[model samples]
Target: MSEGSAVHQWLCWGALYLLAARVALSSETRRPCPQSCHCNSVLQEVNCSDGQLTTVPNSLPQNTKLLNLTHNKMKTLVHWQFQSLPQLLDLDLSDNIMALIEVEAFLGLERLITLRLARNHLKIIPVGVFAGLPELKLLDISSNEILVFLDFTFRDLTALQFFKAADNDLVFISHQAFTGLTSLQELHLDGCNLTAVPTEALTQLSGLRSLHFHQLGLATLQNYSFRQLEHLKELVITSWRWLETLSGNSLFGLNLTSLTIRHCNLRAVPYIPLHHLVYLVYLDLSFNPITDIHRNLLGELLRLQELHLVGGSLLRIEIGAFKGLAHFKLLNVSRNLLTTLEVGAFHSVDTLKTLGLDNNPLACDCRLLWAVPRRLYLDFRGNPPTCTTSDQLQGRYFLDFTESELPGLLTCRQPRILNRRPREVRVDQGHTVGVYCVAEGDPLPSVTWISPQLKPLSSIGRIRALSNGSLEVRYAQPQDSGAYLCVASNAAGNDSLPVSLHVRAFPLSSEKHFRLKGWFAFPSASPGLSGKQNIPFDVKTLMVAATIGFLSFFSSVSVCFIFMFFWSKSRGQIKHTATIAYVPRSAVSSSNGGKGNYMETSRFTMKLI
Candidate 1:
């Protein structure tokens, strides 16, 4: 052989010789227990850790209450080897290859209370494996390769307190698998292959306090999956991709304290009542496909503290959805597809503290901050959104925008429409008053108002323009009570259809005399508040007549004075000319007060002759 091969051979021989010597020494001392299983007579305990022991030793100390046979190559529990240890209280067969357990494997250990079979290759639990252990309190069968569960797997274990079957390949669990486990406090069935758990499956566990059945690779959950487990405190029945049967009323009678249902395929999370679960404080339904939200669904969960809806595809939220959740503290809706929420969506959750909505296609409106209008613990670290019109949201923190402002703070789309023009009309309620109606026409029409008596109220109303400047009308008292007809003439002089109207007198207080039943009193401009009126003037007319008489008397005197002055001037011309003085008719009239202010004077021109 080569030098390297020769050296490796020597090393292998030396190791085997040392191992044989140790086993021989242990056998010579009358201890059939393997050399790896250390023994202590004082404590009466044996620890066989990390070995290839074929079976547990039968000659162990009668006082041994604790035996740890961990990490061994034991294929099956040997009754003859372990039946003599009557005081054994803890037996740990974890990390072993005990694939097919015989029914009487644990036959003689009547004092066994705690058994650990974790990390084993157990396919199915035999009914006799736990047949005689009446006082067993905790049994851990987690991380096993269990595929099928026969009925009555735990039927006779009446005192079973804690059972753990986590991380197993359990596919089909018979209804009787947990038949008589009444005292079971906590049961874990996480990471199994359950597609749809029947409601009656958990109905048998009367004293169960908490149950976790998560990540069961489920697609559908029936209504009866959690039918009768009234004493359950915390439940995690969510995260089945096809689990969609749970509406707001699924878990009706249970008094659960905390519940989780995350990472499921529900497009909408219906509101489920939690009144019976008065002590429920923690609730998680995150990562579901929930999109619809019914109003006032969370009101009954008065004591719920934590709620998770992470990774859900929830889109729309309604008003008053969280109407009276007084004790809620933490809420998680991370990685969801929620696009919109009303401004008052969660206002009624009076004490909610923490909320998470990160990594979602948040409609990214400036108003997302409304999700936490008050000071709150929000975990929207990084979510994607695009509002190309805005500069404030350019790569900054989404909460920087949501928190800096409010929910729905994002910009909304707007549109523009045309404005309508106002119209005017003229009304004359006199004998010729008229009413008219009109529509678009090639030529103007001659519309008129008529009384029911067949007499035309006003000829002008026949051509009055409408309020829209497209019609005209006249009116009489009685015909005005009904709609007036308007005829539109076409380019060919053909009359067009008349637009119909249900017209009556404009309601006025003055028209209360025309009151009809059921209608309000006619609206009227307050009387004396809308017009200009005149008063009687006979006394003023008489005063004017008296003043005119006084003025005329003065007028006649003044005229005579002027004429006398002229005659005197003529005399001064020494009889050269005949002087004439005359009194006009107005002077006589003025003396009898015929007019206004007049002059009165005497002629005193110097006559030298």
Candidate 2:
């Protein structure tokens, strides 16, 4: 054997040994699985849920695609925990006690597409923790203790399509936090402490389709809050305790399909620029305090299909309130304070399929006849609308009223005396007298008078019935001094009142003359001076007899007139006053030869002194 051949054999043997050792080490590192974890080589998956592990295992399969470490005791994520697994497509570390994530913790995960670190104790995310993940498409950090989103937090995640940070302690997000998420389609920040919409952060995600901010601390939605998000399709914002106003342009520049803003303590239907949302199909503004629906409130929303305004403080729907909503299919106005709905309120909505007006106080009179014909499209399945007015229609369903029954039910109100005629009237003889009776009813009542002559008085000689149901008596006499009845009658019923008239006579003057010759001649005149008695006597004798007769007559008449005048002057009597009786026209005309005229005239006597 030569010395050179021996040296070559030894060097070759040493090289072979080193190569075998490397192979053995590599094989050993890939064989063993983490404790209490299941590894399926065929599927390239590892599940370590509820394992009580404190950290990620060091000896994971390099080709593993799905890793789940949920419900574990892992406290922190050091840099590059899965550095050896470049083919990892999905990683879930949810429900872990992870409080910190070191910078570059996911540095080597170039092919990672989905990452979930939800329900953890992480309070902050380092700026570059998710950097270099160009292929990452979905990330969920929900239900965590993250307090703020720094600028460029997701700047490098350009290909991310779905991101959820809901139910976190996030109070602030920088304008550039979501700057590079051009492909993001859905974003959720519900159950967070945000005080305003992340408008600046959302502008970068022009392709966003759905957004959720439910259970937030936001107070108002300013104008153009969602401006430039032309491709947004659906938005949900519910249960905001302080949210009050939504500016008219808050939803501008968006092509939304569905919107929900319920339980936000809003006072009215937020003034949304409906013209801009031409493609909107469903809108929910329930649980608000809106009072009325004015005409054209939902103007020209031609494509709108469903509208929800339930559980509000609505009172009225003005005429033509829902104009230009020709395609409306479902309308919910249930559980409100609506009392009246005007005619043609829903005239423009020819395609209405479901009209929910339950649990309201509707008038249910002729005014509701507009809806009775359309009852087929109404939804009274839950607590039908009840009538709030009309005595005969009260407590009845508006749909049950028929067209003919409505008119009768509407005219059932009895005649009510809005103003009554005077109970007592005083008028001087030969003066005009008038009395008015005013009343109100569904069908205006006709008024007539029962005169002092006990007749049903119409326009006759000096008496006339005015157009306004007033009684006018021209040249009232002392005979018109009794109770007059003013009767008002209508379809419902009749009402009447009694008015007493006192006709005062003309006062006598103190300078009136007294009669002397008539007082003496009344006693001197015989009962029957049948024949003419001729007195034959001389002039002197006749003169003496005449003088004696004149003396005797003058003495008796003067004494009688003096006594009567003094008696009348001392008594203060009203001899011209007279009592009048009121009787029905039927009774008066029969007794007075069908003339119904009974006028009593007073006579005045003139005496010469």
Report every candidate's CA lDDT: 0.64, 0.80
Candidate number with greatest TM-score: 2
Colliding pairs, model 2: 454-582, 454-583
Question: What is model 2's C-alpha RMSD?
Answer: 27.9
What TM-score do all the candidates reach, one by one? 0.55, 0.58
Tens-place lDDT digits, model 2, residues 215-326: 9877888888898888899998888978888777878788888988888878866645556777889999888777877777677666888888899898777767767777
Error of 2 at 239 (Å): 2.1
Output the TM-score of candidate 2.
0.58
Q: How close is candidate 1 to the true structure, as a TM-score?
A: 0.55
Q: Write the per-residue lDDT of candidate 1 for residues 91-167, one digit (tens) a residue.
A: 89999887877877777777889999999898888776677788889999999989867788887678889999988
C-alpha RMSD by candidate, in order: 33.5, 27.9
Backbone clashes for every candidate come to 56, 2
